[model samples]
Target chain A: MNFTNNTYLAEQLKIGNTKAYDYLMHTFYQKLCAYAYTLSHNHDTAEDIVQNVFVNIWVKKKKINPLFPIKNFLYKLVYNEFINQYRKNKPVEYLEKKYFEAVDTSVDNTTKNIEKLIKIVNKEIESLPPKCKQIFLLSKKEGLTHTEIAEYLDVSTKTIEGHITRAFKILKDKLDTEGKAIFFLLFNLDVFSEIKKL
Target chain B: MKQVEIEKIIVKYINQEANHKELEELSGWLKKNENISIFNHFVNVEYLTAHNMGNYNINKAKAAIDVKLKANKRKQRRYQIKRFSVAASILILFGFVTLKYLNFNTANQPKELSKKNNPKNKAILTLGDGREINLEKDKNYSSKNVVGNSKKLLYTQDNKTKTNLSYNYLTIPRGGNLFVQLADGSKVWLNSESKLKYPDKFIKGKPRQIELIYGEAYLEVSPSTKHNGDVFKVISKSQEITVLGTHFNIKAYIEDKKIETTLVEGNVNVKKGNSEVLLKPNQQSITITNSNSIKVLEVDASQEIAWIKGVFSFNEESLENMMKTLARWYDVEFIFETPKSKKYLFTGVLEKTNSITDFLEFIKATSENEISFELKEKTVIIK
Candidate 1:
């Protein structure tokens, strides 16, 4: 039941443990279906694509490599199956274009490196000035408005706004351009819009 | 175009909020082969982060996939049998020998008492229109607003405006348990011998309410912030619990005089008559049915909700109370031959999956042979 380790889960899958399969399904099925939905646009088609990926995993369990992260493997499989379905309907040239895009390493790298970018942002947030960090968390995490944070901290609205603005500036400076873009994408979009207003 | 501006447009496009001009710009940018990868990454990340935001019927999808997997398994089995017919015949000869050995081993052991008293995922779901459905393991039930399988029931959110709310009741009989996720995404784990009545769908801008008719239930309430600040309330016989967002357990067995509400996380207000008390994490409120007095105590919250996790955990609880809890799960009666045996306190954790005899043996050994039990049919006589 302790399948927190992807390597162990991969081994279990290879050894034909149904519990491991169920665990994988329960954990990743929803997210994978959502990802497939983005590509297929229809719910039933998306489900079929993800289901085929899982069925193939079982049918080819012997070839499972324990070292590879199961999450990325699942996403990659779902994407490949989606493309295969697309190939059956579209012309060869269109399919070739999508096939190349599908196999693009940069695209895979961007998603694979998302965890690293998130960690760097977390480190920057932790290194922020105490008052600025407090204001930032209150506004972004606690979903508090500037006035609410001011009242809670017994400070003027102007002071609370100053702390948040300073925190934003510090985070922006610490993160690279790509990191900044990903940070905006991952975090609250409202915060990004607020930065635009500033 | 700058990468940041392009990324912003991609985000907008993924969110379906891009205007005609922005869409044109995105399509133009996506014409470059390299730019398509960036757009794909954004899409992947969006899907990962906003997973719960989707309106898709995930339960239905999972059920559909399960059917496909089952069919695939059958196909694989048939293919394997065809491919290894000769090896399978020799294996079947060894299997029969092994089966004989297993039967001999089991015959030498004591009867498996747990087989009859095993708790199962079973319930009776009464729909809004008074239709009753028996739900058990591997059985599937679906309607317009709800879908349920063996272990859990899910009420899908209906986006239409409704003037009146229709209520459905799930009753967990003895030796049975059920889990239900409400239309608002709040989850309720109904313990054995419990019944819960909840709306088919929660109306926006109105307080979401549910009632526990006469049993125990652990509720993880979806936050009001997710539902336009609509508060959730749990009504029982003696008290009403109001929650903004929280995980709590309410035990209000009809046979018991007190209704106990244990808070696991977040804050909840337990209102009894005119008096209301706010409970924090690790705090519990016990309200006696006959009186207006409510007692607040500090206790281990995990022990209170251990039933949901397939364990019976006690902290110096009396043998009588322990037996009552076990009786609900095992669907057996406990009779005390020696009245003093009922007063003996026991503090230990017993796995629900274990047989009744195993628990009795453990308690007997722990009591230094002071307590003994005899299993007669469905009743355990304590001496």
Candidate 2:
């Protein structure tokens, strides 16, 4: 199955092809189940939740927009399924920690886009200057602070900050130019608009 | 605060390091919901990478899902969907499209691949002496510091000679399998129809390398600890597996759609084109030859390495695919007398020690006699 080509897959799934459905389920079952487990903390419920999301997908597949990120749709369904159980059981509560986080419905959709984008972004990231890619991965993947990244690389904090800014700028440009089709698929008008203003 | 400062504050806020005032200010900044979404993008980027999402039972989950799908259909399936499910599966389907698209010429369904006369120990080993030796089980051959005992070929390297590199090849035909040990003490279990070109000896200060010209091979690489941290690299047509010391299986058959490298132990870097996927133990990386797309997945490594144990282990493998694989092992042709039987799913283990006819019988029996097979000298007609 072509992970990047849902246009082809969407047609297959819409036709009630269980083979295609099996492929999709087989590809995503483990990851989504594990992700559900993290939220529900109940093994059976996690498995049930993941299974329900897929069952619902097979049933309601006709209503789904093929142009959209199907994987993101799957993840959103998984999230909703877990939340449905959470509402019923109340076994544990979501502790909103100290982080002043922003919630976006687009965030989940962006995740599917990010998965496809990772390959392109990684290729583009590799072509960047060594220190630049290093700093970008440190900030993004490792969640390192500018001061920590600078200390690790033995550079000034200003240099670290500069590298990060340039890294995002370069990534943004590359993604915009080469990743136009993917950008549209990943971002709705609102999120895309917000990104441009940023 | 400026936009960049707002971004910094959001990052600080997400990291849980912001003071109360900074948090209050960040909350105020997020009053415009658009900014919140943009901020969520970065937060999501962090979330996607930060989780160690563990493994789950794929077969068990799929069975559960399949049951649910079937149950749902029984209850309330649309009429159009029911009709389409019976026909129009014209999508080339999965990575394995051998017979080409039937839609191009629906009149010409695939017919008569070939005959099967059963597999035996047959291989060709070309020595550095330019001598070609035909290998069969219990058949011994020795020449030019190389000796073979039917199943395995042993190379005794001439270390004192001043040389760049000397190469030898062991080619296993479509119905043949071979085992060999290279000069570096690395053990290789070559699957049927594989061509392995290995150097007669390792260089003084270089990595040990071998090329799998085509087909599959399981390798138990000699540890770098004994060889002074030297890396061993296996190169196929489009992909390369580089390892320090690990047990891994490489299936790069030309007949197959994708080149799959499944790591059983240690670590390996499966490099194809400019992309490199580092595979931890029990993970499998598949590289599609046509599109150059690579997919990495966690697999049951033992199932992949089952051929080494002379057993077929599958988890819900399709009948057509399983027969396609079985055809190579038993060296036979599969004719689907009933095409629907091709779509039948089978699971569990079948030992290779059984005769090809017996295996087909077992399959027929296990599928509740719903599937029948006509076993001949060279063809097994499936019904």
Candidate 3:
């Protein structure tokens, strides 16, 4: 009954508690479906993908690791299932033309890949010059307007913009060299354009 | 191409805003295998962030999975029984005991008296010509610029040539709820016994205005940046809410003296007469009808907008106030047998799709028989 504790819920699932399964479905069904729909685009296909994921989780409950966060596990399963279906339904010519061999599509590897890219970006941001880092954090992390950040820093708005732009340029260049194209894909560069418009 | 220029093109392409030239450039860049991987990852991240889960029938989806799960269980049960007969018998016995315990705990669960008492997707849409259309589940209605299916009414973003605004009113009756998508893609979820007045099409370069005539509504306003920097405004009797783009809930029931506006995401300005206050995320502004004062408080914004997610979440709300909300949604009247029972406090989350009896059972059980309910027709007499 105590769903707040993931370990307890995992134990209950392993012991064959229908209520625990029901609670999981109620909590995460829609969100996972939304994630799947983003990949599949079709309503029925998304529902089917999510349903299959849930069924597999229950069927393999004995192997469920209590240490793993169930939410991330469910998402990984849904992503892998979507990829499986995509490869099956895609035209052979399209599959041949696009190379997916370079990508690590394994469940654990894909999640780790995304996490690694984020870690690299964070490290790069941490190494920025003090003023540039402060302005960048204010504009992006705190979601402050240019004027607000300038007021806080006691500087002209143009200076604030310059610092943010410089920070983005440095991070982008560093991340591009380190993680290749995947790093910028993870980093949000929209703040740069917002500053430019202002 | 410069890195920033290519990034901009990729962003536009993922957003489906890329022109032919941009598309050609993107395709040319994507010709490289590594660039193709980057484009795919970019699309995945963009879609994952931008896409809101549109109105999907959760109950229907749950039922579909329920059928599949039951079949899977049966198949597994057959295999388990064949492999370990003694263990399977023990499990069956344990399941029987657990079922008995559950039944005993819910012993006094009331039978649903009538299906009419259940809250449903029913509303009255009054067009500009004063014609009323009944919108309900399984019913469909469509016009040149509008479409109504099931519980949602969607206005297409077209007809930019129109000069004068033609307003429409959506009145949700007691025991009913509705979802409306405005012409500018802003979404509004109306609770039971609520009415919203909005124009058929929001003009470009003009602030989009709508009125929550009465009752409660949760809105996810489309960002003003998308519509030529035109802001969205929601007006009620007590106050006006101005938004650039935000998710907020407004409760302005006719019977209640206080009008509450809770900001969930982004920023909103609450203006009452000349006084205005800007609200941050998780902040709520309460405008009293008798006074011009606006009081701001931090609240769990998710709980305030739980109705849109088919939940009734209350935090130490008085029994009287909670009953009022239940009465509106169930289309039933509550008569307290003793005034003391009205002050009983409740803090819990209940599913909106559950019958009134289930709710009463929950309150009764939690309150330790401090309060009880007697159902007769559409009246719930609380004792």
Candidate 4:
């Protein structure tokens, strides 16, 4: 049944019918809780959200227009309460961070392993010696041309080229020989695959 | 920008050798744009390093926020209640009596609702002659092979008069329909995605046998005449509904593990492999698993057969269960993203004629679930 014409709820609320209020509360409280939980995934918050919406509705019964659809009004109350809860609970810093961080936590163990390896490599690069790392970082990480590095470093273009070639050879040898073996021991992939991917 | 242009600029920019003019333009553009920065950064970082980070955890953040909101709501509700008492006192002095009367009248009044207002409890019946019929369609019938009941339909061949008809089989799709008429003129309406295998003609000495491949069907089996066995049997996967002449509804959906036979009138002896249950009027027999244990419950026949009258009646049915009901009538698929949604059930009746969209919106309002429906050319997806 639609219950569209159920005005008994309004009448009971007006006269402070405890039973009517209880009935309405019982009928909708769970639903309100569920809606709140879906958005927040917290039981206490959901309960509070529903409870506040109902209290507001009851307080404003006198001002509720005679022609207003009660169901629509009730829904609007719940929605507004949910939004208010969301805004109050949320931190502004969360909005600035990327949205995908939460998803990373839910990944399975196998996926996490690959992720860990990636993190290790990044950390290693960050921890490299200052001069060597700067050259490597500019060539590989920052993606600078030898000519640009020479111009920026105020060195001869040939000297910049020599630095990158030397850096590449060292990086390639480490990864291809000792690095490849270590990576194989952990991840089972060839060192060449890692170097080529890089 | 071209890929080569981007790559060259990135190299130049990274080397810190770009001229002042070039550096100014690149920095300005990168600062002004997000997409460019992402692409540039993505290429510059090591592949493994860039790809490893998982998506941001919105759920955790939401949970934290929810905790704070809960405390706020508790405070707000308490304050609002106190404020309401004061405002209510003032309003009572002005229009207390009128407001109370209106509220009383409104609550007491029976809600006027269009049929098909709720879709969860509706049943779809496909006829046995390879013709699909929506039982929820309006009350007009033009002598088609399929007969549409308010909640179920009946289909039988007039081959006795025509004398040249062959075997006719009706197939119900998952979330499909099946409606059929027995030789003795008893009517049966099938639920979604159910199939009924029956013959056009009944030989005098042969038994009236119909195999229910899948889904549910309500039987109003006619009384056998002349006592030549006069037995009517419905064969499903693990259960068989044997009724001589009775009004009962048997729901044997594929997903359900039990075959439920709710008898409205007369008696139905449900034979499940090795076990059987004798059911009386208002009694329901459920054959569970392959072990043959049957559970019978006393229920209102009207509630069981309400679909025959074009109304779906549910008693504390879960949202997952409700989705099955809607799936059959509208011929759609349902998927629940969260497990908690299973705990929500709705107790209501929905008219069968309402648009699926309208029905979902109404349920979303009253039930504990949110519905997002996508109707493809031939498939309806409910999430």
What fraction of the true interface does each of the listed models get right, in terms of native contacts kept? 0.13, 0.24, 0.06, 0.10
Q: What are the per-residue Cα lDDT tens digits for candidate 4 across B288-367?
A: 76677888899876677666555456655676787778777766666666667655545555555555565555555443
| Candidates in descending lDDT order | 1, 3, 2, 4
Chain B superposition TM-score per model: 0.71, 0.68, 0.72, 0.55
Off by over 4 Å in 3: A1-198, B1-114
Backbone clashes, candidate 2? 1
Q: Lowest summed lDDT over 10 consecutive residues: which window, candidate 1 chain B?
A: B91-100
DockQ of each: 0.07, 0.11, 0.05, 0.07
Give the Å error, residue B11, model 2. Answer: 42
Off by over 4 Å in 1: A1-198, B1-109
Candidate 4's C-alpha runs over 4 A off are A1-198, B1-166, B174-178, B225-229, B367-383
lDDT of 2 by residue, B143-223 (tens): 666788768888765767555687788898766787898887899999887899998888756889999999889999998
User: Which residue pairs in candidate 3 collide?
Assistant: none
Tell me which of candidates 1 and 4 scores higher on TM-score: 1
> Per-residue lDDT tens digits of candidate 1, residues B173-248?
8888888999999999999999999999988988999999989999999999999999999999969999999999
- Chain B TM-score of model 4, please? 0.55
TM-score of each: 0.48, 0.48, 0.49, 0.40
lDDT of each: 0.74, 0.69, 0.73, 0.54
Q: What TM-score does candidate 4 reach?
A: 0.40
Candidate 2 per-residue lDDT, tens place, A10-34, comes to 8778887777787787777765764
- Name the regions of candidate 2 deviating beyond 4 angstroms: A1-198, B1-118, B337-339
lDDT of 4 by residue, A1-198 (tens): 222246656655666665665666645555444344434434555556666676565555566553665655665676567654455323433211221122212111123244454445556556656765677666553445666766788888756655543443343333335434555676655666798899
